[model samples]
Target chain A: MKRLREVFLSALMLENPLMRLMIGLCSALAISTRVESTLFMGMAATFVLVCSNTIISLSRKVIPDEVRIPVFIVVIASFVTIVDLVMRAYFPPIYARLGVWIPLIVVNCIILGRAEAFASKNDVLASVADGLGMGGGYTIVLLIMGTFRELVGTGKIVMFERTLVSLGSTFQPPTIVVLFPGAFFTFGFLMAILNKLENRWWGK
Target chain B: MMEAARTYLLLFFGAAIVYNILLIRFIGLCPFFGVSKSIETSIGMSVAVLFVMTVATSACWLLWGLVLQPLGVGEFLYIPSFILVIAALVQFEEMFIRKVSPPLYKAMGIYLPLITTNCAVLAVAVESVKPGFLKLNIPYHYSLPEAVVYAIGVACGFAVAIVMFAAIRERIELAPIAKSLRGAPIGFITAGLMSLAFMGFAGLFKL
Candidate 1:
């Protein structure tokens, strides 16, 4: 239980994936263009990561050394495909918005990198903790990015599918927030803010 | 055929310039972020990726268009087939480049192998396999050489972006910046800025 708390907490701030490791910025930058898509993408990635990490850790000892990477990849790829098909079927709107990013998860580097770096070496439970932590970290970053982009770019907080979490009815969302450059500028501001807080607290 | 060829060229160039599979489109970024620390290495890895992408695209195209598309398995076979083809092509390219281009092999180092996992190549494979994927003025019909050309052009565009950014970055290292944003922080900013600059060429060319 304590380990789980540590895992979630670490992923939240102490070892944030984007700001600290810089492992998976590709999807971070691209999918963060919209709030709904970012949340969907983040949750999907977290699901894949958690499952794959558990499976990899479980099979680590039995898997032969020669085919280890191949095994990990097959596991990861299967999950990605699973997510892709499921999204295409149920979340067609999101599936379309995500487009190549859905498939791009296979090469996310974070998933594969984690499978090899952590899962393959760690125990099942610890790997689960790590996966949960990392995925949580990833999701947190995405949510933050998504919230910023959505609020500033369009000036409306469209959450999930139907809910309009807009600040005020009169508020018109900044259209630039939905565009490409908005993703960057928003990310820059967030990064600056995160850095300032981190430095103030952590003394970086 | 000419129009079709031009379309592939358009996709190839489009993915490179406008969409930019690397910095902009967010594909093939592992290499872009990992190996692009130095200009010489970025050029080498870009060439390596360019070669592998061109070959892998054609190989997967044949596999999909001829084998999968006819059997109606084209839709579902993308991820599996692409992963297989890219992995195989990366291996074969690694061996071939090591043999024929020793100096090049030495420069790229391990990134040559990592290209198999690069999302950019995977993106090319996925896009090339899509039903009615358009290039420029022509309606894209999946063919052998066309796939290869499109892949090469896209990779070249990536090569253009990374190589250019890499050169700038190398020079920028000498420029004065605040202490907080020196290395990696500035690198990310630089990538963001370069991507912004690439936006200016949005409607420059049709293909």
Candidate 2:
């Protein structure tokens, strides 16, 4: 239990897939314009990660060394296909907004990276914990970025067509915060903040 | 002939600049940051991407039209099939390049394997075949010529963004930046600024 917690915590903070590892930025940045989409994207990615990690961990022994990469990709891609079909059927709006990004998740380096680095070598339980932690960390960062962009860019936060937070009309918002470049700027500053916090606390 | 030439030109510029796969669409960012540390390496990466993206997209395009669509499993199977196509292409390209040109292989060989996971290649492949995927104001269901041209344009856009960013990063290395923000953070910030500049190119050409 403690080992699982350690693995989870390390993935959550010390080795965050987005902020620290920086493996999966493309979809994170693109879908982070709204909290709702980010939440859904996060959930989908976590589902794929956990499932693939578990399957890969169980079958790690049978998979040949020379063919592991392709095997890993096939595993990841199958999961992504599941997410894609489900989203297209149930969440048409998000599926539309996310568009090609949904399919692109197969190539997301985070899933492949973890599969090769952790799941292949670790047990199924640890792999599940790592996947949850990494997915949680990724979702957290996306939420932070999404909230910041939506709040600042529009001066309000709305999810599911409901206004969750509003700054009122007195405040002016910078439209750029919601655009493509804003993603880069927001991610850059947030990562810097995370770096500062890590350095101060860990003394590294 | 003039009309066809003009359409191709518009498609190229539209993909390469107005809707850049890297800066604007935000695909293939892993390599955008990973390879842009040095201009030389970025150039190598750029060449590898250009080669692989064009070839891979063409192959996937053919596969989609020939195999997946005919089998009626394209909607569900495209993700896996496209990925497999890209992974296989990258491997084949590595071996083929090594035998054909040693110097070229040395320049681009290492980056080939990495391209297997670069989302831009897959994104381009899917977008080319699927109509309305990009929202680029162009009609979809691209013919082979159009798809190849669009792939090349997207690759060129990626190359332009990464190579230019690499040049800037080479200079940024000399500047005194905060320790925390010195590396990837600052790179993102720089890309943000560059992306803002790219936005200015919007409406310059409407296809």
Q: What is the TM-score of each predicted model, taking all chains together?
A: 0.90, 0.97
How do the residues B98-128 of candidate 1 rate in per-residue lDDT, one tens digit apiece?
8998988888887787786788888787777
State in Å the error of residue A156, model 1: 1.4
Q: What would the TM-score be for candidate 2 when compared with the true structure? A: 0.97
lDDT of 2: 0.91
The residue pairs in collision within model 2 are: none
Q: Please give, as one word, the docking class of candidate 2.
A: high
Residue A173 CA displacement from its true place in model 1, Å: 6.0
Q: Kindly give the stretch of ten consecutive residues in candidate 2 chain B with the minimal lDDT sum.
A: B103-112
- Number of clashing pairs per prediction, in order: 8, 0
Best by DockQ: 2
Q: What's the residue-level lDDT of A150 in candidate 2?
A: 94
User: Which ranges of candidate 2 are over 4 A from the true structure?
Assistant: B100-110, B135-139
lDDT on C-alpha atoms for all candidate structures: 0.77, 0.91
Please give the TM-score that candidate 1 achieves against the real structure.
Answer: 0.90
